[model samples]
Target: MRSPDQRLTSEAKVTAQSMLLDPSNASTNPVENWRACFPEIIGRSPAMIAALETAAKVARSDSSVLIMGESGSGKELFASAIHRLSHRSPQPYIPLNCAAIPENLLESELFGHERGAFTGADKRRIGKFEAASKGTLFLDEIGDMPLALQSKLLRVLQDKKFAPLGGNDLKEADVRVIAATHMNLEAAVQRKSFREDLFYRLNVLPVFVPSLRERSEDIPQMLEHFTEITNSNHSAPSVSFFTDAAIRMLCKYSWPGNVRQLQNLVERMVVLKGGGAISIDDIPSDIIRSIEGQKEQAIVSTGADFQPNFQQASSAMPLAIGGRKQIAIPDQFGVLPEAGIDLTSFIEGLENGLILQALERTNNNRNQAAKLLGLNRTTLVERIKKRRLAVLNEPSKEL
Candidate 1:
């Protein structure tokens, strides 16, 4: 028999592993059950799935999630998904776009102001926190939020309370705040453009929504989806397939604007082409115009305008995606170093990498792992089979 000390040490290690891996330890994956949260969120890309999984994990706890991505990359969509999967799913999910609101009025908008609170004081109004009582309040484009307001937000997040703009009374807010931003808040903090305190508070959990061009494989599905929707309103033919030539044309473009851009293209195609089996000829003039250059003739590459080519020398070593490393893109790409370089085959590699990470962290909690990675449980399973991630079908009861 083993000594008591040895057994105790072994048990402790097992417990730690279980806690880190177990969904039961964290609470049921409410996000798994709440599918409506991502009503508009499209794509089954592994990168996106991994992001959703991380967001769901962050959601279970009351940690404030800082969503980072390029503008129009669907930061708010994931924010909404997190709220819908939280305990506060039944409550309101309020969105405040910091960039859109006037700096002076933001305070009154967040923390209700008393009548005569300001020159334009209307009446006693509830702030976003109060309005989101027991629910989630999403702060969109928080990086653009005024530096003056960041301090107040940090205070409220820390204290769970806020004072109306002109009122002395401190009101209690039971709201869960989830902040989103496109700017590099970390760089912002270093530059002192954003407050350090607020960054830490919001950075407790971070969710990323990858760009559309980042996962071009999802383009085919998204194209079919948009085409199907458009086919309903107007149609000469109820066809489903795109000509290989047309699909090739799409796959080549860089899609700089991401999914919204793709959606725009789809809408344009549907209206302009009058809906049917789309041949390359049926494609729009602007899209046609953009692809006419010799660079576009390659078809495999839409050129640097979309996913600018960059070469990374690190394919030999395993790059950790979920580990504690801050995202850093190589500088050689000549574009924003933050966006990373594109690879012809790296899309497949990314899929494998994300699936492996999700399984590693989730300890095979398909439901929890799926949420951590932002994958549909079914999709995760499909990928597991496709990539063969070696996960348990049933969630381990060890938790």
Candidate 2:
């Protein structure tokens, strides 16, 4: 049965995302297949495997663990693996997304209350702490937890006990703590946004998950796994895979959003293309833009990549603009200070800097530089444009 929240999003953009909740409903992907591809609990990367080994070592010990990583990076999986490998595997494993709970209700949710403790308490209940007694309680996205609750959580971790929202008595739980976050606690500490003592308590046994870009070598395997799972969900008789060309394009693109973005892309492609292959044409315009931008970046990287103040200019640039509005380019935006001085020399120097960068980008090849600069080779020669840029000081060569 669909929940009320699920029904509310029935016409939203993520209808298909919900459909993917039960891939086995369509086809049973051999657990071994996924395990073989992704292989490790978190991943097959060396750092991740080392993390697993460390987690296994600590699994038997009755100590709190903190799994840290960026969003979409698998932190809960590590928590579950820890619980499964532990002696308390027979008990329940409770996973809570702390950010999902409302601030007012968090106290009630974490610690059970008497039948008449609060207004919503129509009957007695077992809180997450009691429910996960003798097991693990995985707290996901703990960074967003309110400061007031942090004290209580710290108390729970320290004494393994907590009082219900409205009760005067205290309850004890044997649940092991496993907290996860995408936030930088050290920075939060400096900013006084996070409780220093709570941060220290949860800082034990920290496991940091590497970003996808750091281990891009694993992307191919991840994509293959996601594609197959998607195909299975679609009731496809055979496995779906990206074509070599499509895979090439995917490899070329920089995944800023990491694995989650890749998963979303694969799901979108499967729904829209309805085949075992994802073609370049099937890729969305933004994805194509990312790939093309990477290619252009490679060319620009040879010389004009930075051009000084590029990042500052980029920060100043708007995310969206009117189709007809020609927003100022980096050159126009990097003008001199507000001082009423001869801005001509500064502008000319900036132009020269850009020109030099363009020349170096083409490796002192005059014709290529001219084309890159949107000028004819003859025009460049007539102007005696400097072809010897610092990035490449070789003599100019014709196209």
Candidate 3:
């Protein structure tokens, strides 16, 4: 019998071949062929799968799409996928970062400029809108777009037409607009920094990409994917495997920089280790310290009889998720009753408080809260249900 790894690889190859045979499978249900077509976008988490499905559905329409996610969470990848899967795939897919470009040049960059429009305008320049006509224009970091530019953008979206700088003729825009931002546009709108009209115009179809911590279960796969990429790009030797302890430590890390951070770490590891097996020592010291801190906190919070046998536990439980080993203890305790204390009620209340705090830190985003508490979404929900705590602004209880 083939080993599990070999079997998995064989199955993946078969699936890829089948997808190639039926090209229509991608258009009809792109999510089904997500791994085959979008290898750069990696995640098997329910949160990610849902976001991709929504993107695929919206890709069929020409309506605007607003992608919300933390920095380095691959918003551009989703935007590109939408453009590629859309009817305008034959046309250009232009991307311009509103934050990267200067405010003065941004207007001309989006609306073009005629000769002698400004000091640097030596000749007629085609802006993003004109260049992306009949295609897609991805406005990344749209929240950082100047208020003046937002008005012009709103006009273009509204009328499907725009005039170049220092030009009288109005050019028709047949392009779809896909805006992405790491900022909270709603908050920006409330603060009068981002235009309200522009926010509504871009938010026709919103797709929220969950942060890396929200989908830590996919870390192993992502590490492998990045490893392969690093090897192929640098022509390094193939990485055999990552030690289970190393994988667990990585999975438990709070990736503040999201997917991009993980990719960078993987590249560094491949180069440093020369594509050999990655052991726990090979991981960065900060990551190791973070994992250790979390483990220590978990033990202290539970108040359970904890032993420092992590290495033995890791070796024994090679597949333990998040590097945590659960030890069950009998519910026996010495009771001192001057005034009777309800231990059950106190413990329950403490648990509820922690859950609420986690929810608050994550802005009531359950997936993120679950990660914060080191529990899966289902377990988190069950805890919430048991405690009967009211959570406001709970974004779509699904996953």
Candidate 4:
């Protein structure tokens, strides 16, 4: 017979194996057919995997779900996945953006309106709730919904019935609610901007989508996905693969706009570069500057070599400014050399370089150029005047 400790150890090992083998653990048991399961969502980070697992579990039920994440973090995709995984997949999955519609017409949009309900109501129309009676109703930017509408929404949730605008009889609805928002509903409730009761109702099954910055490891996969999309959409100019250095720079970027920004960048590059391999030169100057800034901060923090890694990684890389080779300021023992760097001059040079690049990219369209440089048109004009950049001071043209 085995000793008590040995038997307990064997039992623990069996339990561990069982947990590892569980299909719900996305990290260990990868979903063999993710395309069919989560067609729009893509990522392999621990946070993303955990979120997908939670979404899958919650999809089995008809409970209301509130998805929270940064803007462009793919909350709608999660909402759609939940609907697809649920029993109501065959039914219509209607989506409505609460913030996009005007406050005056939001009620009519949600519950629909009858003929002669209002001055502009020439004919009767069904609302999202009625349209998605047996399916799902995805409410994007739910926190931006007006306080007055929150009460009506709460009533519908409580009774599972609603009346169309200016209607007398109550209509039944069997729709599942999946709301998404980048705003903090709890804070909104505390501020009285959002109803506390309504917040509780919508947040029954909260699923937080991780931002792209949080899952930097997924950048390469996302790049590939976007590239494929770009290629499929256009002919003649096929998508090009990013160089290793370029990929590293992209992975290091803090994507404030999340996946949407990355997708835009990919499409822009694919359109501009035709079919060659994407190098550091293909990247936007703003993005390159941001990456270099991050590297500078890291070097300062670690008191390491001040020389940027990119310089060594791609010696032939063209500088953003007039194709001049980037100046290397050597440091000794974590200290500035006797010939200390001119900080103001360096900043001005960087700014001038970015402005010139933006002007060239936009074909001398001042407004568009200013937007690319994240400056007001007037400010850009003023800078051009200050720097005596006569080339940029030509007649302005709107794009």
Candidate 5:
């Protein structure tokens, strides 16, 4: 029998491992506890929190999960989180990108081949399904899976058994599947490119991850997190920080490529700036141009000529949008004092003021406010959410 000290040491090690790996030990808050399960997913926005909650609830079930999100929005990360939070976490978590493989070799890659299964099949090879038995298999870009493979995959999910190529024997598949897709599978099904049956089977538990722009409030935190991670990964002396002005400017960006693009930008900045305060001046010209382009469009939408230079703002400038009342410019307007006005900030402030006024006029009715602002309800709601305005009511309630 082992000594008491040895047994105690063993127990302590186990406890420590459990403490680090178990999500329950992370926090007292249920949402935070779930968030702890996904350490790599950085966001506290309501949309992200909702997604985490859904993922946490579904993680306990053995049903197949379908993660839907735009490319680079971290659909695969969500899949991994689901696997990690599942009973199959101790087992392997294999990921395969259906879009990355060729149609000829994709089947063999998913379901291994026996010796001489095909021209290149010289030896028996394990496939993702067999390799992930008793664990989780993440099929990324599953919408891109060929129709032929989709039928076979559906069969495996249904029968829990698959046969290898050139082999008569069937192997048991005790795998939990988590599929992710940026494509609209419903549309693909209508287009006859994707199997409708497979889509429904995998979509038993659907989790929609919000894009970066939908949760822009998380950008500052994400930026800081990315900066620290990049600094540590690159062995920088210290972590870099973005200036408040720089962060505000970045928050204005649409982030079309989402989290991946932000992560790449953080790495680029850490490498280029050598770990220091990153100001708006340090921001890439393309990013600035993108923001400027948006502002130019907003200006044009107001029936005003696009003014590239803020300093050249004409006095008594008339602004009209969708037959709205024209703003009466003051004589002192556009005249810069010793401290020149930040036109971008001024425009944003004006926009917010108008939105607030519209909401008030409509008695916090988002749809009516949107109509008053000459914007669609969806666009208005998005703006309100981005600005964190809690005054608006549900779009369903007109009054």
Candidate 6:
């Protein structure tokens, strides 16, 4: 049958697929109906599921939707999904980037200009508002629109009518607006850069898309999706898969650039390292440095904080220590001080406190105390003997 190399390759492929497609048990997991609406959106993390649920609910309405997210987090995909699920799915889905056009031409871009209206205007033109009639107009980077343009946009949203530049006739507008911005519009309003009234108008129904770092669980599936798309579109031999170690390192990455960065990495690998499984060595040097740097930083920080942090961590255990001055723990206590602690005394005190609390709760029943502390009865007895702890009674014997 198959050669040993071929069999190994098949097994690796299966393992990669399993790793990428593990089922999630999150309560907000997207159902089949909702998933069907967003076939292009490639994530099943709880954060993604919650966002999908929100988009599905808001899709039925014709109200303005303001999508807030970090750049490259796929705000446009959500906008398209909402339009697809809405009643206006049959109509044109027009999109315009507010930040891309110049200030002088932006007004004309939103609400067409008449022939000879401006120096460059040669013929009559329809803007996004008129072009997106009875459909959805996705305004990307709406936060960057100039103040003058913002006022005109607010008027159109309120009155549903606008006069073409150099034309007096008011044109009736019937368009559903879906705006997306990575900026905090409230902060912009506070700065008096963005119009407060326009912000509220667009924010009637708000949707937030989580960043790649927040939905790290979805990275494997996303990596797989990007790989498949890259292989299919490119003319080179297929970049088949990645090694398990490589995938683990990728998951640990913070992904500051989010999905776009991940996709670019996959495409770069396909072009440079196609035709085989990509090992950890295949990953870019900068990414490896970043992951390693985070690990080192975590280790150093945790080690410095471990003693006091251990106290707080152990406090979360089932049994609370008894009969001590209940002083509030301060934030500064989490850090290691210059004086440092007596390790032996600190450990013994913490252990004794827990044991004493457990024994008190169980009324000096050795077996019960052992159970509470998740220790063997024999082990608990040895500890008590070594510590010379005084037990008042042994009424309940071991079963």
User: lDDT of all the models against the reference?
Assistant: 0.65, 0.61, 0.71, 0.72, 0.72, 0.72
> What TM-score would candidate 5 get against the native?
0.69
The sequence of per-residue lDDT tens digits that candidate 4 reaches over residues 263-381 is: 99999998788876888889998778766765675221111113222111111322322333443332121343222332333344446556766776777788999998889999998
Candidate 5's C-alpha lDDT? 0.72
The candidate 2 region of ten consecutive residues with least summed lDDT is: 313-322
- Candidate 3 — which residues are off by over 4 angstroms? 1-39, 237-240, 298-399
Query: Candidate 4: which stretches are off by over 4 Å?
Result: 1-36, 237-239, 298-399
What would the TM-scores of all predictions be?
A: 0.65, 0.63, 0.69, 0.67, 0.69, 0.68
Q: Rank the candidates by lDDT, best first.
A: 5, 4, 6, 3, 1, 2
Deviation in Å, model 3, residue 39 alpha carbon: 4.3
- The 10 consecutive residues of candidate 4 with the worst lDDT sum are 300-309
Q: Which ten residues in a row have the lowest lDDT in candidate 5?
A: 306-315
- Per-residue lDDT of 1-399 in model 6, one digit per residue for the tens? 111122224443333223223434222434543454466688888888888878877877889999977667789888877776677766878889998998998888888989999898999998888888888899999989999889989999999998888789998989999999876565466468899899999989888888786789999999899988888887776556777888889998867566888999999987688668988999999788767765665221111122222222221222223444433222223343223333443455457667766777777788999999999999998776544453324344545
Q: What is the Å distance of residue 375 in model 3 from its true position? A: 34
Clashes of each: 10, 0, 0, 0, 0, 0
Error of 1 at 388 (Å): 36
Q: Candidate 1's residue-wise lDDT over 7-118, tens digit each?
A: 2244433332343346465335543322222434676667766776676567679878888776567887778766755667667778888888888888888998999887
- For residues 125-208, could you state the per-residue lDDT of candidate 3 as single tens digits? 999999998988999989889998899999989999999999999999998999998765654664588898898888888878
C-alpha lDDT (0 to 100) for residue 55 of candidate 2 = 65
TM accuracy, model 2: 0.63
Worst 10 residues of 6 by lDDT: 299-308
